[model samples]
Target: MKQVLVIVLALFIVGCSSTSKVALSEDRFLLTSNDPEYGYTENKPIELGGFLRGTKSAGAHIEYFEGLMGPNGEKVKVTRLGSCCEFEDKSMPFGGGLLDRYQLTYEGQKKPVIIYVNLYKFNKPLAPMGFALL
Candidate 1:
């Protein structure tokens, strides 16, 4: 019985960690992460892709960056145009529901900007969460 329980627990953990991919359109894809620290470890800029799916409260933590840095270490302008959180989970803190949509304006940007989304509620100041150069 103990061995069975262990197997079940292991399976459960693995299942919970698995990623879910949603196709928004032909070129756009949605990547989800139960762990909020998904694309935040690398210290380099991330080439903009489709979209980042994490906590809805991600917008609150986004106000910390001055702008994005280009691959050549040049400063790229970043502006938070808007945000949309239609799908939200109230159970989560600060209403960080299913998805927090953030629209940004990138000046002279032709690619994506890498950012670190702050998963912690208390930590207001944070690194880049991620950016889409569009």
Candidate 2:
């Protein structure tokens, strides 16, 4: 009986402890919208979707950055993008996640360039936080 109980407890603990680590990859799961227009690609004028603002009780965590990349892989003019009153959450457990979408353009580039998107954090100039490619 003791062994059985110990085994059960161990199994329970293992099951409860199992958690999927949040990876900042190009995985589709990172996207909060299903507009099919959000993601990395050769497509210019990428769309940085919007999100719903979190409430006082339960909030969402959403962040984004955009910029143009240079030939030497240098980021320039990094911009912090957010929804209306969404970035105002300066408290713990940030407000709601992104829901709406915004667009960006890759102009003035004479050659093939790379654009990036950093999620949930401020990426450096031309540096994406989540996932991005040329």
Best by lDDT: 1
Measured by TM-score, the strongest candidate is 1
lDDT of 2 by residue, 6-124 (tens): 99999998876543222233442233334333333323223332322343212211233322232232333333443322332343246533322223333333543233232333212
- Candidate models: Cα lDDT each: 0.36, 0.34
Off by over 4 Å in 1: 1-63, 93-108, 111-134
Model 1 RMSD vs true structure: 17.7
lDDT of 1 by residue, 7-69 (tens): 999999887654221222322112222234533433222223223346554444433334333
The lDDT, on a scale of 0 to 1, for candidate 2 is: 0.34
